[model samples]
Target: MSAPPYHPVVPANPADADAIVACWWTLMAVHGPIDGRMYETVPDAQRVYREHVRRQIDASKGVVLVAPTPDEQGIKGYLLGGLGQRSKVYAVREVGMIFDVAVHPDHRRQGVGEALVQAALRRFRLRGLSDVQVTWSPENRLAHGFWQKMGFAPLLIEAYRKL
Candidate 1:
């Protein structure tokens, strides 16, 4: 469903932390089955993620942006991306990584997700990084489609077996 109109992507503030954490939990829960079993309860997950995001924000890894609901009621979506070398796990060099991105369920079909991604890319471009990468849960069709639609192609596949 199309989401209500939201503001274009803008830098999020420290005060936006709680809402973003809430959105992150929602994102994880939706993809948990596809990625892995999430042992952390929502509160625990929020605590951990809140700190993680803060560190990223302070480090200037890249950009943290929010798509706020109309009239600044709250955030409808957020994106976390950063500049860094490709993981040693992959045979690639420096690339921008979209660490996290989530949109409220009510805002799924709207353009919020795309706006956040484009905003991230714009930040990367300013940093002189062209190539970028994103990893989504293998079983997440929605994310799969979104990333693909965003012009990202599969560069590597990850396979693992429960020990």
Candidate 2:
């Protein structure tokens, strides 16, 4: 049989919450071990997404792109990003900030993440944003490697100390 056909990128709708959540959980499972935190309970993740991300998407300043199965039965990966004014040393202007990009374990190494990033970049260009940035935990070396391979260089580093 021929290899399964995959749609690398597709616009996400509010109805995509379930699929998006699934992808999010998968990512958390992968990274949580290094951070020493338990994976977020499903309800907690859902609440946060609904309260924050869903509203941003509805407001048109945010987007969630998904790579779904060929028949669109379920999503295998997703990228969430938003358009906003970012304060930079030079000036403040619209920029695209990618909050999350995740691909299911089975779909890893299949170019899904790259496709989603490209799609988000295209959307940012259409919105006239000047730049795009993604932030990930310092422990996530895999993500750092991926971003580097995508031609992104670290522009800033942040540190914090608790009193």
Candidate 3:
């Protein structure tokens, strides 16, 4: 098969919200086989995306980057990050916190995720930020390996339990 067309990450505006939601929904559905424990259904995934992901983007926090198909305007992947001081890893004053990243299943392993990450890093650098951090589940070995390959090292471990 031919390679999908590429586009640089652009700042996600309210106009792009629908596409972003659709892309995130597609990602959850595609990964349901492997990450089904996190999301029970597409609607559940949509609710979380709307309440948590989309709601976090504002003038004070961070920006969302979208990679839309060249032939189509729909999003194929996206990365959300923000400027924050994370004390768990270090005492750094300013760091880019990569909150979420996802690529459509049909587009996985094609460098989309890497491209999104690099784009986010570029944005951070442009904003005069030096450090970037990503948090993921320890059980997700695939994610761990991918982040390591991207030159990220584990700084801390956070555990959770049901009450």
Q: Top lDDT: which candidate number?
A: 1
The local lDDT score (0 to 100) that residue 69 gets in candidate 1 is 83
Give all candidate RMSDs, comma-separated: 3.5, 3.5, 3.8
Candidate 2 local Cα displacement, residue 148, angstroms: 0.5
Query: Per-residue alpha-carbon lDDT of model 1 for 28-143, expressed as tens digits?
Result: 77876664543335557678889878877777675789998877878989998887886578665678989899998888888899999988998888887778888887678888
Per-residue lDDT tens digits for candidate 3, residues 1-163, read 9875465677776666777777777656545675566546754656666655556665556768877777656777888888887557666688898977888776788788888888889888998888988987676677888899899999888765556
lDDT of 2 by residue, 29-120 (tens): 87767654334355576668656656755767887888887878888799988876755765746788899999988888888898888889
> lDDT for each of the candidates?
0.83, 0.79, 0.76
Quote the positional error of residue 111 for candidate 3 in Å: 0.6
Model 2 TM-score (2 dp): 0.85
Off by over 4 Å in 1: 1-6, 38-43, 87-92
Clashing pairs in 1: none
- Candidate 3 stretches greater than 4 Å from native: 1-7, 26-48, 51-57, 87-91
- Predict model 2's lDDT versus the native: 0.79
Better of 1 and 2 by TM-score: 1
Clashing pairs in 2: none
Rank by TM-score, highest first.
Answer: 1, 2, 3
